[model samples]
Target: MTTSVSIFPIRHHGPGSARSLEHALSQLNPDVVLVEGPSDADPVLPFLTQRGMKPPVALLGYVNDDPARAAFWPFAAFSPEFVAFRWAARASARFMDLPASATLAGERRNDDHDDLHSDPLRVLAEAAGHADFERWWETLVEARGDDFEVFDAINEAMRAVRADAPPPTGREAQREAHMRQTIRAALKDGAVRVAVVCGAWHAPMLDVDAFKAKDDAALLKGLPKVKVTLTWVPWTHGRLSVGSGYGAGVRSPGYYDHLFTTRSAVTERWFARVARLLRAERLEASSASVIEATRLANTLAALRGRALPGLDELNEAALSVFGWDSDLPLRLIERELVVGEALGEVPADVPTVPLAQDLAKLQKFLRLKVQPEQIDLTLDVRTDNDLARSVLFHRLNLLGVPWAKERYAGGRGTFKEAWALAWKPEFSVQLVEASRSGQTVHDAATATATDAARTAGTLAELTTLLESVRYADLSGATPVALAALDARAAGSADVSDLLEALPPLARLARYGDVRGRGSESNTLAGGTFRTLLTRAGVGLPLAGVGLADDAAATLRGKVNGADAAVRLLDDPDALRGWQAALTRLADRDDAHPLLNGDAVRRLRDASVLDGPEVERRLGLALSSSVPLEVTAWLDGFLDDSGAFLIHDAGLLALLDDWMTGLDATVFQETLPLLRRVFSRFGKPERRAIGETLRGGGAAGRGVRRELDEDRAMLAVPVVLRLLGVTT
Candidate 1:
């Protein structure tokens, strides 16, 4: 091979390297520029320079059939490759590297070949007496003029450091051989000057002829093949940060963009942006603050011996001049100014899988743009568009794309859904992978749900998946989910599971029909509800027997759920059967006292039992039971309110007598459970109970005097009128 090729090795996102390369390319005027990237991406080079195309987008390559085997070559506005691509597009260039299908296949089996090359930047940083390579490199290289010799020096240093390193392994050897072959082919094509831009580490190896062409060809021969596709997709600044889980990601993409765009007056421009951001946040950041912050940044640069202020200095200046004692203001600067929130754009005509196109249509229709910034959305489900957005968010979440998270916020109203949405670069990858299930988001989510339903082993899991599917409106998978539900429910003997599963189905049967569940789904859900409720009614009483505190507590929830389900179902026979089961549990002596008391309270709330029956049950529980049993009974009875004690003086007196009879030890033992039960009481009810203990009848009204018959009769019509119930 000829020695006519000059390789400019660069740190991936270094602004200084970009400037140097640009200058070097202008002076050399090479006929062809070869860059390090997947050779399969050669055809897309022209698209990279098309008008309106932006950086921070990536060249994505994956197996067409198996998307899990994939790789990304991301480019930020400051990336040297991005600059090279722009220059090459003006002067026509080609990509020279192994194809992605080969790289991915090699990666599958190359895990055993450990790369021994240490980070070259760290070695140089140590030699420069700096703890961080970025800071040192910025001070020495980036802040200086664009001299192409800096690349030569960097190449020499990296070569010297790796001189004692282990020889390249089999896969790496084959890759280097292929690169050499590519360079040989380019030179033989009569190109007078060739410029190659590659990662700094690979430069030293490329210049050396370590393997012969014939041996390299044999090593690369008979390589495994896989179908692969290439496309361009958007990326984000948050994901461009190293902490966002990309190995080659930068610490501050915004800072690099600033350096790349405005190579001079760096501190002045940065502080002005910070001032604007602070003012937008309603914090005080005037022009005076901007001037002071700029001064402080320059001072910090001087103290740190940096040629110019970097991100660290600028952030420190913002924290100091903003008069914030904490880093809270600095964190805002980091998010808004240091890292940025920009999302890259791909052309509308760009080719993508059908699923991606469908998703884009849905997002556009919903006016939801995938961005790097976290946005809070309050959706009223009564609004059609809002409901559609909610459904899309839920489907994405279930498919393992967490672009949106449901947030529990207060006071937004019952029909309002709160969500926090922030799109990451990996979400595109997830979306692409999810396409294997179906061609649309709904279809994919439904297929995934169906698979989960088929594999579920428990009634609880199936019921949960069913609820999710119903909420997400995945109608196509309804049959699969319904079949799984029926199978699991028919086999499940747990009364609690049956009871817990009935409410959602009952709600669907009652109200879901009006919410567009279709007549078929409503009918299926109604049938499932009836079958499970029937099974639950037969087994509930037995389930109550011999329940420990935890199990009994769990069953009490189930009982409450059963109460709501029967009411929602409103089927005369089902209600009567469920009440009968509750009556049996209440009357059985072997049932847990908690269950018994729950049954009695439910019966009272349903108005099936009169005051006298509640009074009789209270008297029996108070007089005969031990202190713990009595307290447990009180726990279930008192569950969440003291309103029951207000209307019934006889029951209140019964409680008073029971407490007075308990000795000091029993009182102490009962206090905790009593506190737990009383804690559930709201403020108004607790205050009324306290007043009752002080001899004030409900709400400090003294003992109810005999109502004057004439006055009370006259007040009846007034009371009815005030209650909006005309006589």
Candidate 2:
């Protein structure tokens, strides 16, 4: 009636350890197999063996009340724990760690400062004359054949290392105590032979006879607990790397995967894959290059006195054989083959919230692949499928799951939208939290948007939410948001806020046409746009008056935004009203010169003012204003481009004549501001303006240019033929 326990310690994500563990498990065939994972995740263990279950997945455990307090036990196909789970599915298996309830409760002590206990592998690796523990382990255990004898060597080595190491304390102490207790319970349950799989650092401490059960119970007592929920979520290979901040992560999960999956000719297969990837990118990688790379890798490994070529040797060979001058191609190889960007999948029948289920169904229907790597998606809203994709992205963003962030699609018009998408694992918790609003993603997002709109403190927030609602096509939320927006607009007196709110409203109105929403949406958004524009126009003159330099610049930006919004709407009445407001601002001598000059420029650009009127305004501003005020006036008039100066001969001559009349002191003072204004122009336009000035000013240059009547007349017959006139 004696119970025997065999402890198999492993590096968390090591492919070599995984392969060895699998082979060892097949030989031992213990009565019960236990792995290091959240014990609360035991219920979902069955799902691991399901056909649709893929690795690069994690067991997600979170506090039921606050999903933000969560933990992940990630498992890749090459992880020892993943292999153990698969092995344990046929036999009896269980998770043998502290339940996630206590772990997520955040009650662990921090008094333990023992370096050896914290990272025993580092101490052992240092003793072995290696600086990096990962490389040392890979050279010794991973690169070797799958022999159970390596476990004995690992166990013995850990025993020697722990002989001088400090006793585990705080959370580490509690975890080992719990692991020992779990082993005792398994033995007491009539299991003759038990298999305990855990981290190499904790392997030497799991003997049931080495620690007292009473002491273990006392260490476990009074641990705080909370209501916990567990489920499976997809993970990614990039997230499994040490660079991603995963404490138990490997340096190269993809390389480890190649090690575990490729049993024979590992270096050959890897080099072949690298060659194919290079060729796919149109880089020069030939069959001869692949063979040479493989030979160089094996040769280097032999020179280093190693059993097989590791990632370092393989990479070196690839770099040397590929004749790459930069590490850029090597980095590409690393990303594609070393770290990888593979995303895992969970089975459809897995337990999850209704909103998540609905999203999955939608993703499948739309043929959208949920990936870990960021991908650029351009949606043509005119197509039914792309339109649905856009709606889904907007709705998800509303629910605070920014799975796809909106990006500028460039000038493709309203028919196209761009998004940068990269799905995160924490989005699962977001989905669960959002489920309280509704059972489906669309409904939940609509409810969330409606609530936000109702509680929005300002008209700008309301209009912004309204724009998102329109994009999402949230019919249930649109009316509520619009009503909220109108109420805020009526009470709002800040003309700047009114102006700020106009652009989104105008866009919403214009987008209604693209979405084919009929007159109802257009009327709602267009009416709101008109009301805000009218209020903004009435208060703009007062807003511009008596403003300081900074305040004037801020107000000018709002004015520019409003003008652009009006043009975007393309409504004649809106443009006329906006132009009238600009005219009043321009005529008010008390207004900031920046605002006055910008107003005049807007009128000129709108063709409401003729060339003579603009010339008169420029002359008056330059003569009546001080040096600083004149600089501000010029900046506002020129805006950000010198194209106006390049094309308008009279305006350029007027500016040149004014500069020549300035006193030396005034010219010195205004030099910086003039530089600031002209620096905003593009190089080509600035060069053109300089040439016009250098050729004896715009007016003189025009008079100096000589045209030949014969050369001009030579093109008349060709022009007549092009116009289809029989001359």
Per-residue lDDT, model 1, residue 426, is 75
Lowest lDDT sum, 10 consecutive residues, model 1, at: 109-118
Candidate 2 overall lDDT versus native: 0.85
**For model 1, which pairs clash?**
none
Clashes of 2: 0
TM-score of every model?
A: 0.80, 0.89
Candidate 1, residues 1-727, lDDT tens digits: the string is 3447888987777676676788888877887888888777887777788776777888888887778778888888888888888987667687777778788774554322222242455456666687555567666555454556677777887788568767676666666667776776777787768888887777887763554767767867886767788888887776777778666667788877888788679889988888888889888889998999999999888998887776778877888889577676788888887888789988877778888899899999999977878899988878899999989988988788899998985522256778999888777778888999889999999999989999987766776677678778888777898898988887998898888887778767776623455678777888888788888888888888998989999989878977887887789988888898898888887889999988999899888889899999989998864888888888888778889787677777778777766888989998897888888889998887777866776533433334468857898898899999964
The runs of at least 3 residues in candidate 2 whose Cα sits more than 4 Å from the true structure, single-residue gaps closed, are 107-123, 126-135, 142-149, 152-168, 374-377, 407-413, 545-552, 623-626, 657-672, 696-727
Which stretches of model 1 miss by more than 4 angstroms? 92-97, 106-119, 142-146, 170-178, 218-222, 378-420, 442-492, 513-517, 545-564, 567-576, 586-727
> Which 10 residues in a row give candidate 2 its minimum summed lDDT?
107-116
Tens-digit per-residue lDDT, 568-639, candidate 2: 889999889989999999999988999999999999988999999999999999886588988999889999
lDDT of 2 at 189: 88
Best by TM-score: 2
RMSD of each: 10.0, 8.7
